[model samples]
Target: MLHTNHAKHRMPVVTAVRLAAMYEDDRMLRSIRDLAPRPEEPLSVGEVIAQTPIGTKVPVTLFPTVGINRPGTDRWPVLIQGLEEIAHWVRTQAVPRLITGTEPPEPGLPMRYEISVGHEDERQAMSAGSTTSAGERHKKALAAASARGDLAEMISMIDGSPSEPQIARWLAQLNHEEVLERMSPLRMAFDYDPEVERHNFEVLKGCRDAALRFGDSDGPHEK
Candidate 1:
């Protein structure tokens, strides 16, 4: 069915249809989520309704269709505005990343550098720039590595050799860049495997050095 928002914005037909379907699904899911079968605990809804489907690569915290039953809380429109950017990243950043094999595989790391389909899910982190906080600083470094199209450098940042301050500095110094390049990082990543999961970001480039200084024997070393 044609939606007003769809016509107004002229979004991709498939995307618009998918978005519309969520509203319909949300209407139903929220109803079940509200049901409290136990009469004794009516105030407390025992049912848990997940906002996202299982195995989603999107952010787990925010649901575009969340609060569909409540007015002024829908975020689908927010996502709609960002669809182009998201699409661009998937096509340019994520797709190229997936197709291109990780080069110069790090010593003692996974020797299997050949990418299997569906592992290059880190759209947000790789596209991040240094503006927000320490977290963003790290992602910005990864994003810089990604822009250079160097997967090995990305691994180095996560595993060994502190990524220079120059990368983020260079991005900030740029007088002109693509709109996509300047957009704030969306904070997402691949969860297809534990080795490549977003949580691996926890141990960044400087972590090992800091650990060595602090004498934490458990810190991850070069691999």
Candidate 2:
């Protein structure tokens, strides 16, 4: 399922970029009510580990308009590497949980929604420890998403920090295949023409090449 998801990954990006273009299309659309509302003040980032309805699934007909600035995810995302993972999680766990009412889901792919309402200088890495910010991996992955030109650059511009090198490496760690799975439809609408299927197809391959370059960038013979 993951392999097939990877194979068909390009469409998601094309669709994502298409989504990125929405605000640019009609500034008036911002007033829509049913869509996730932009908060007057920033919302909290909940820790789903303890309280989120891990595997609950709801049938969604429309793509929920998310992050006001980024137009991506509203909730802190469930990091999935493929479409099939989502399906499996929803079908096996979420549905059963819905039926049983008391059955809780085992975490990971199935666990997405964070129940706790929860961040500024605390926002950037948004992770904390007994001392200063000491979060690892996934935070770095989030940073990489914010730094990449093909992505966060178009949605909400972010400046680089000491975390730059780590995020780049983390983004590289994503490998090309995993990237397509993680993306919020990358803002290709601002750049690529969605009408041309081949162009969209090639762009993802180009992303793969860039991933190779990141891997090489750290080598003694950096390409």
Candidate 3:
């Protein structure tokens, strides 16, 4: 399903601008001690990092609003490049986790969810439905509806019920994931990241094999 939740809770415009400003102006990052919510109180660099929308998938337009205040005509590209550098740093350095004091879940715990990409609405559902049966049901319903509409459209074209272009324009006006969604008249039926998951699985398997070979001594470590 498409994930749309992020659209509603987008990072605030001011926060995006400030973070973009920090990236565009080295002096701002260097003089981080001066950042504050008000005139008298000083905010630490870590605090700023916590407040910044590190993981937010905000719109690109926010960058231009921040860049217009700066000196050069080339500010947009420079800001983009700088933001990329910062994102790289955030991922590798684990800066977001450090500042937020959040940690990865214990590997022993059951796999709660899997990462998949979809449209905005689907994304929203995935986030809200995490580890919940009801969420899964909703997802399936949406998928089934979408499939039905697709099958219906294909059948209509094959049967010569209407011109393809006419059907397409009608479908567009319905403005839904599947024409059935808004029209309600149609009916129908219908990688894992190997580098990370596969690598982890292999390591675990190797450890298990070695523990079995060593018996009691190495078995405890496997646990």
Highest TM-score model number: 2
Residue range 54-122, candidate 1, lDDT tens digits: 786443222222111111222233233344344444444555566665432212121123344444554
Candidate 3: residue 82 Cα off by (Å):
20
What's model 2's TM-score?
0.21
Top candidate when judged by lDDT against the true structure: 2
Model 2 spans with C-alpha error above 4 angstroms = 1-58, 61-196, 220-223
Task: Give the distance in Å from residue 84's predicted Cα in candidate 1 to where it truly belongs.
Answer: 14
Candidate 2 residue lDDT tens string, 55-161: 96433232222222212333322223233354555655667788778565433222233224443343322223222111234455565555464532221223222
What RMSD does model 1 have? 19.4
Summing lDDT over every window of 10 consecutive residues in candidate 1, give the lowest-scoring window. 62-71
User: RMSD of model 2, in Å?
Assistant: 21.0
lDDT of each: 0.35, 0.39, 0.37
Model 1 clash pairs are none
The global Cα lDDT (0 to 1) of model 1 is 0.35
Could you tell me which 10 consecutive residues in candidate 2 have the lowest summed lDDT?
A: 14-23
